[model samples]
Target: MTGNTDVVVIGGGYAGVMAANRLTQRDDVTVTLINPRPTFVERIRLQQLVGGSDDAVVDYPDVLGEAVRLVVDSVIGIDAAGRSVTLATGATVGYDYLIYAVGSGSADPGVPGAAEFAYPIASLEEAQRLRPVVDAAPTTALVTVVGAGPTGIETAAELAEKGRTVTLVCGEVLGPYLHLKGRRSVAKRLAKLGVTVLEGPDAQVTAVTRDAVQLSGGRELRSTVTIWTAGFGVPDLAARSGLSTDALGRLLTDETLTSVDDMRITAAGDSAAPSDLPFRMSCQAATRIGAHAADTVLARIAVEQPRPINLGFFGQCISLGRRAGIFQFASKDDTANRFYLGGRPGAKLKEFVCKHTLKHLADEARKPGSLTWVKDDERRESLRAKRGEAPATAERAA
Candidate 1:
């Protein structure tokens, strides 16, 4: 609506960068992205970062639009009413609209000694911190990777391939999101890597120590390094700022990604809880949501109706070192199918996905709205059905 329109994006992850780049479509819109780090973090490759195979940091100019002003500062608080964000450096930056894309970090383990002993590989700093510690440990040292998520599996494989003795303690099942067929493929690869895969309820970790990790079954294993890769948790910025959020502190928003409490604020990435049901916390969902978030703001500026988010996940891909991987195919809704590409082919595909993700930001940075993703009308309706709402009901709510 105005050349002076100011949009500040908090977080420079995939979602924030995507939003910031797409916002450049409107020359009148001034976009400023505030992040704690100067380089872009490739979160999907954090395991590789820990393994020292990749650095996981990209220059801001590589992914961010040239028009975007990069503010290397953390947002301590958001004054929604005043339309300003307080930075950690004791400075306040005003904004006409704000996008919350802080993404996520490893959730609290809630087990004894976990916080003190286990290292999480969620953030770039965490991975950097773990890399040195992992390198210092003897090759014979027992490396226990807790949780069965993609992060845990990838980390376990990454370390094991480096000649480190590794053990993967799955709380219940390895790759719980993967279909049985896909799970078997991953298990076979881990086995080939000499990674001890522990499953079942008894495999659930109940405690951790500097030298050992205790399971729920009363089994204690000697572990020199414990890597925690459990659930993900969002920043408390939304809650602390007195904004409406879900129980996990993700900013609650409607289908249009607009905060329920303030129309001027929107959320994207792992930090967003749309209709109290967040999509899986991954770059797959983050980039799409980020583009939609920017589109929502653009729609508002144009005085047009903003459309609801339409997202469809393709499937899951877990790299078993750099040599092999398991890429499970699925419906648009994300449930794994019986078919999948395993071994070297899957590894190549997984590598392509990671590279293309960065290319997406760069492409959008140059072309603004050049990015596109798959979507299904049936999938959208099913999501609303789960919320026990009709199409008209969701429309009015939005």
Candidate 2:
């Protein structure tokens, strides 16, 4: 903790930026964040952006603290043993510790021609690419959204509200995460908006084309636009780094968020799979994970005991349109853990949550290391050092 301790975060999303901000609070840590884009694209708001909202994105300078250095580059590989990251630009970053929060992307189900024919709104770039097609098409154009997750539901509802013919196709019932009451309410909203909902007992997407989608039921749904919002798949960076990953390529980490191979490396968000927790790919988990990662790094640097993360999702939110939504309550400490809230009231709550999350992160960026929510003692009592590990000091760049 004497010399310049470099902490390189391999992503710039919510978790990555928050980690960088938190680490920079200590005088000895020099935080470096690497991301492919220059601006902070709000992944949660991509559906809103596609539905014609420009208020979702924040300028990088506006979100990252002055002490946190930003590197607009792609990460090609990681050298865990040497504690270095290789960039697509051929530059290598040496770090005393690394935080992996590269996040996940849309999964292309091996359905025939799906990847080649369907459009995905997972990222800002993808949304930008789809905007023109949406605008050029006629008002009555048929737009099909695959996957009835939050993203799909939001996109379909938003489009239908915009006076377009929107059809939502899901392998399961609409908003499978919602409670029965919430699901029924959302279905009513879809019906009111004239949006078509197709459940996949027999209509699973088998093929996608520029002009149509072929379902397993042998029905060809004519679509001028096809938006995919299915599940997510982790990036290859974890596996490429030679770290242990789950079957889905998510890096497996101890409760302390440390990678299985190297305790000095931590991971969070959709890309990280904690040994104690099941699959949860939501912003609620990402925020807490980011804070926990920062605490782990800070504790290790200070030679203090690290803490364990116990954050949970209260419930889930699915936007039916710009003005309607359903908020399901759960026991997740961070989100609402109650029944469902819907209609204008639920939409207002959902909007508040989205805005508030960004605002909190933004405020944290301005004042790094101020969050006490992620207690240090939690890490120390939960994360015990593994035996037989050598003190890693290799300096060769990746």
In terms of lDDT, the best-performing candidate is 1
Q: What is the lDDT for 391 in model 2?
A: 30
Candidates' C-alpha lDDT: 0.93, 0.82
- Could you tell me how far off, in angstroms, the CA of residue 169 lies in candidate 1 after the best superposition? 0.4
Which runs in model 2 stand beyond 4 Å of their true positions? Answer: 276-279, 333-338, 372-398
CA error at residue 185 for candidate 2, angstroms: 1.0
Weakest lDDT window of 10 consecutive positions for candidate 2: 376-385
Q: Write the per-residue lDDT of candidate 2 for residues 1-398, one digit (tens) a residue.
A: 56778899989988888888888778888899999998998888888777786536789887788988899999999998788999999999999999999988877678777788788887778888888888898998899999988899899998888899998998768877776777888899999999999995865888998899998889999998888888788798989878889888988988778888898899988888877343378776677688789889999988887866766456887777888988887654332333788999989988888887777677778887665443333322223323333333322231
Could you give candidate 1's per-residue lDDT for residues 1-398 as a string of tens digits?
Answer: 65679999999999999999999998889999999998999999999999989999999999999999999999999999999999999999999999999999989989999999999989999999999999998888999999889999999998889998999999889998898989999999999999999999799888899999999899999999999998889999999999999999999999899999999899999999988878888898999999999999999989899899888889988898989998899888877899899999999999999999999999999999998999856656776687877786568888
Question: How many clashes in each candidate?
Answer: 0, 13
